[model samples]
Target: MNQSRVTDFILTGFPGLHQEYYGLVSFVLFLVYFVTVVANVTVFFLFATNRSLHKPMYYIILNVSACDLLFSTTTLPKIISRYWFQSGRISFNGCFVQMYFVHYLGSVNSFIFLLMALDRYCAICHPLRYTTIIKKCTIHILSVTAWIVGIGAPLALVIRAYPLPYCGSNVINHCFCDHIGITVLACTDRSPYSFTAFVGAMLTLLGPLAFIVFSYGSIFVEISKVADPKSCVKSLSTCSTQLIIISLYYVPRCFVYLASQVGITFSAGLRIVIIMLYSLVPPMINPLIYCLRAKDIRQCLIKQFYITTGRQKAQVFAVSN
Candidate 1:
């Protein structure tokens, strides 16, 4: 076999940064993973352990946290492991699976969060009709639908990309086998792929933005009904939280995925801008959003801390005995 027929790719991290940053980068990444996992797990557990959080809003909140939890899990660890351990090499099959997880989980976060915004819109805007409209059955069906769209939309891409023979350098340029990375491997031409990528981007990115804008648009109209100045001001806080998180999540995504399609240069800065938007902002800021705007989650966190401390003291007493 000629050297040109080799079947693997190398990822050189940080085009501009020092190689020693691998260890430091990995350490920092691990710390972020730890915090993200802990924060979401606490949200999950808080929802699980408390009965008051069983409301539709909290259920949506817990699921949002769960989505972010899965979101971070899908990509961050592999990034850390790859940079530090030189264990970054992935088999073709492994790469496809990673791609699917990243794709689907990201889609799930978007749709699930769109539903959350809708949930808030209904609850605050139509308090009298909220319970009847968004019942448990509705919650279950909506959640299932979000997950299905997330997982299903990318099936065509996976089937198309995987079957084609990779007759050239298999090295994935990025840390992951992103759609474009894998698409580049197709020995065959990919003109028809444009439609599929466009649809997927619309479904996962643009579609959610449309829903968010529509929901918030209606929400503001309802909030405007509050003649009380203080309540109107208070109402803006919730909307602002959702808007901030949405911008942070969507701006870079639109830049890298959607805007790049429009011939914008996808330089390193664009990639870094996106990384902060999706990877950093959503996980770290979402918990803050819930804490600031959500009364129940804040209370749940408070109760969880006392309960955990009480259990710790009880364990100490038992050990002393």
Candidate 2:
């Protein structure tokens, strides 16, 4: 690991691994990718085509789906190509471009979750003003802000931290240009720079985490005052989902960052698996979670399906007549 090394990460990715393991990994990854894409696209369709789902929650859901799509797009193709074709070589600029999208959008994902907490808090605590407060413009502006801040903030930090050093080899353990992995390749001693990046990561992670915790805490207090039976249960369920999502995203992230900083050596496969979990696992399950808990989205999906079916039936009947 030389500090003055700069080429690009020559990834074996997944395809170039043990021949026997390639099939299994490819099948699983492809299946996960398929399911995530279908589910997210379905969510997007339901949100955009149907006028009924134009609510604040679904707006955030749309933003998340977009992020997940980008996240999956950033990682899966590389891994798939790596395994099936043994083509894992990426250029220096390509790696940075990939890193740019991954970091910027991953940051966006975190920020949107924070926005979701605030949306929930507003919907729950200030029911009368919910509609007026979380308007379309509000969601649009906030989402765009997430993208800008997420990408711009990390870029500034990287410019300052990475002094453009070049070392020896460019083998990346996993499929992607992992934040710390690339940082270690710089020729300079990365302690000062990495510490700054670590602090920045913690800051990015903490902002959303604190917002979620506080918003939910306040939501619970407000919930206790509500008398409606159905409303109380619904509020709790949504809040619970938020907590689960937060835990899923931040836990492995914390481990990856903390352990890397402390010099904990992780096996390559396990390390890749851990990083991929944030990108892979939660995305596959998010639609199901949202559908199961979200009465509004569920109804909208059902309604859309029925309408499509009904239109098909009407066309057939007319043709026969």
Candidate 3:
């Protein structure tokens, strides 16, 4: 069978979306990209400048921030341009590259969340050995391992999907290139590739989620045994921020992925909305949810703010004199 392979793919930002709403949608996406970049960059800046934040937990946070930043950058810009300038076309190879980073960063996030859960569990459950167990070297090793695994896992999917005969449609229903969105466009039988992707996605999402659940379960049990109400409240508060971020990241994603796998029918627009929410919102608010509220980070930001203000005032006085 002779077929003309497509060399480009068109990304439909939102199927059935009106041309009139393009500006509005593009503006909204730009805002999300802007905020996510600024917030995660601020996190990087804080971590770099503050020596006191050089600990295991904050190191995990640093990894998370970097992952979130890269993920948002990988996805948001092209979609924004799609809506804003009516430019939705991506080269075949470029699309595959984007797909790789999207999945890779997302998998890295899942592992980072597991690392966070482990950190909390140790701090609450084994205070005496927490420092010894989760050292800087250990975090470095684990984080490097996460990056390697995350990179390797998605490469398989891309390799399998990229060579498939894409002789039919060149339109991707989703905003970005992903395994499902890309593989479904191929003319050949996709069951093998789909099943492979399904299993990989499940492992990437569920494996870490299971560990996180166990870690937090143990944390709650330990917290309950504490006699002092103040100590209990503090422990719960510390865990709450992480819980909220984790829920935002994992719940909607699991829902979307499972819904698609199970043949649950839904509108493309609604699915895209859900995907955007889960993908963009967590990174945008992570700094606010975790870093800004942290006592040490807050102190560092305040101290820096005052110093900058003082320097400005001193410069003004010198100019006047």
Candidate 4:
């Protein structure tokens, strides 16, 4: 076995897509990245500026938006660079860092979604104790727990793969450095690490997903017990937007994992495209879904807009006087 370590890995990028499309793809991806950052930033600023929006639910939403922002910042710029400048080379250390963050932030997202579901469950299912249960201190603790577990879990996986030398090939078939993508390049037998990765992936994704499903399921049951139709609809409306975002995040990911495990083959290009769709689409739309659908955020944004416009009008009147 070759012991020479690979210094850098070249991303394979889209397999069959012609060079003529690179510009278009990069442009579109850039647009998505820009929108994702702006939307998340808007939410973060809104939460910071508006004390009225400082409830536990909105705080959790703010954390999710922040995670989405960091997730995109960590992964997208490199991908855009790959297409825009034809620069796909990433150092071994750099690749591992990217791989770590990609999975770490992903785990953080999953946990945050779980927390959001729990918050909703408390708010709706046990409305009487919701405030006492999910207090501000509890929110802070939960947020910290998500970050710690997110970083620690992925760090373990990355460390497990770290000692394996990558002497076989320096080309990663996917756009970004991911655990599976990097593990496949190992000089040693990949079964152990691959299995570890697969299991870890399932635990990280499905564990939180299971909790979310159960929480929502219970919430639904609780909603059914409500005698007033108007109250029931109002409760469902509060959760509907989150459910949509949760579905967007988990469903495609489950499909991809199931397809791969079942020996259903996808072309490299097709698989990467699908992966990108699932990964990028959620971050781009998460903030929008919440801001547009959630009543508090919408109200906050509307207030902000009017405040800004009113200030501008006052300045203009003062200058005229």
The most accurate candidate by lDDT is 3
- Provide the RMSD of all predictions against the true structure, rounded to 1 decimal: 2.8, 3.2, 1.4, 1.5
lDDT of 2 by residue, 1-321 (tens): 324456667876642367878767777888888999999999998887878888777888888889888788887888777766767788887777776677777789899999889898888888799889988899999988888788766786557534557576677766787566666666667787767776767677888888888988899999988899898887788766666766788788877877977999878777777777776888888888777767788888888889999999999999999
lDDT of 3 at 209: 99
Q: Give the TM-score of candidate 4.
A: 0.96
Winner on TM-score (2 vs 4): 4
lDDT of 2: 0.79
Residues 35-58 of candidate 4 have per-residue lDDT tens digits of: 999988999998989999988888
Candidate 1, which ten residues in sequence have the lowest lDDT sum? 2-11
Write down the lDDT that model 1 would get. Answer: 0.75
Give the higher-TM-score candidate: 1 or 4: 4
Query: Candidate 4 at residue 271, lDDT?
Result: 94
lDDT per model, in order? Answer: 0.75, 0.79, 0.91, 0.90
TM-score between model 1 and native: 0.88
Stretches of model 1 off by over 4 angstroms after superposition: 1-9, 238-240, 257-266, 269-273, 311-321
On TM-score, the leading prediction is 3
Better of 3 and 4 by lDDT: 3
How many clashing residue pairs appear in each of the predictions shown?
A: 1, 9, 0, 0
Residue pairs with backbone atoms closer than 3 Å in model 1 (clashes):
9-171
Alpha-carbon deviation at 318 in model 2, angstroms: 7.8
